[model samples]
Target: MSSIRLFILSSFDLLGPMHGHRLRIEAENRHVSLWTEISVGAVYGAMARLAEEGYLRQIGEEKDGKRPVKQIFEITEEGRRLLAELRRSGLTEIWYKHDPFDLALVRLDPASAAELPALLQARLKALEERLAEADRINAWAAPYIGVTKRAALKHGQHRLRGEIAYLREVLDDIDAIVAEVAAGKV
Candidate 1:
């Protein structure tokens, strides 16, 4: 299932009949780009694809002054069914991957140990900033959202905290490893 497809169908389901331009705006307002690989241009392309696939039906078109006309769309019954399926899959699926960090760490050059600590320290600094942002979001959202939603927000923060802790340990180990490499002892 394509995330862009799911996002388009879900947006129509929630926002009622809307044009692609409006959908793009709402998607940005909701911060969909932050967590997903979907681009702003992809929204229009997904809308076209969804329409081609019979999931979305264009109700009509509207034009304002000299601007290009906008095609208004609504979800079909099949779209609703697909949306439910996608939502269920999203909740139940665990997407595991070997991250780039692991690959880079494994490929680190012992001869370049002098440059490695600064690189890792830069990554550590980034992780720390991410952790801080996650904490801020969790704190800010806790009061207004439901228990489950709040827990979900905290889950992100918790993961960041764990990553930060792990990175700290790695940073500490980096110096020792660099020393050992410089001494030709390992």
Candidate 2:
């Protein structure tokens, strides 16, 4: 599913009529980038495309002081239908994206095996940093956000923790892994 499309349609459905600029601001304010694949810069383009596709319709235009006229838009019945479909698919789908690290692990040569520990250590460090940041964001947003958003934040944290634990286990067995790789048994 297109996250941008879902976000745009849902925002319109929930917030009434809004211009592209307002949508972009709302996306940023909601920290969509942190939780979803939506890019803040893509909001305007997506809005334009949604209008072209008849999912959205321009209702009016507003001018703020010297700024150019902004075209306000609202979701159509088609958009609402699309939004419902996206929500259903998104909630029901079990998406497990493949990580390149798994490929690298299976394809590791004896020489690369020796270097795996350092590389894994670096990745672990980065994941730790990300977890710390997630914690801070959760603490800051907990009072303002609903349970669903808090659950999303916790989901991200849990994934990071899982990876961190896996890395530590691998690191603990690095010597054995290197031996296996050297023996061409891995």
Best by TM-score: 2
Q: Give the lowest summed-lDDT range of ten residues in model 2.
A: 106-115
Clashing pairs in 2: none
Q: Which 10-residue window of candidate 1 scores lowest in summed lDDT?
A: 29-38
Global local distance difference test of model 2: 0.91
- Let me know the TM-score candidate 2 reaches against the reference structure: 0.92
lDDT of 1 by residue, 79-149 (tens): 99999999888778875656798766665566877887898889889988987887776677677667866
Q: How do all models score by TM-score?
A: 0.82, 0.92
Candidate lDDT values, in order: 0.82, 0.91
How many angstroms is residue 49 displaced in model 2 relative to the true structure, after the best TM-score fit?
Answer: 2.1
Count of backbone clashes, every candidate in sequence:
0, 0
Residue 168 alpha-carbon offset, candidate 2, angstroms: 1.8
Question: Please, what's the RMSD in Å of model 2?
Answer: 1.6
Give the alpha carbon lDDT tens digit for every residue of 50-122 in model 2.
9999999999999999999999999999999999999998898887899998888878998788788889889
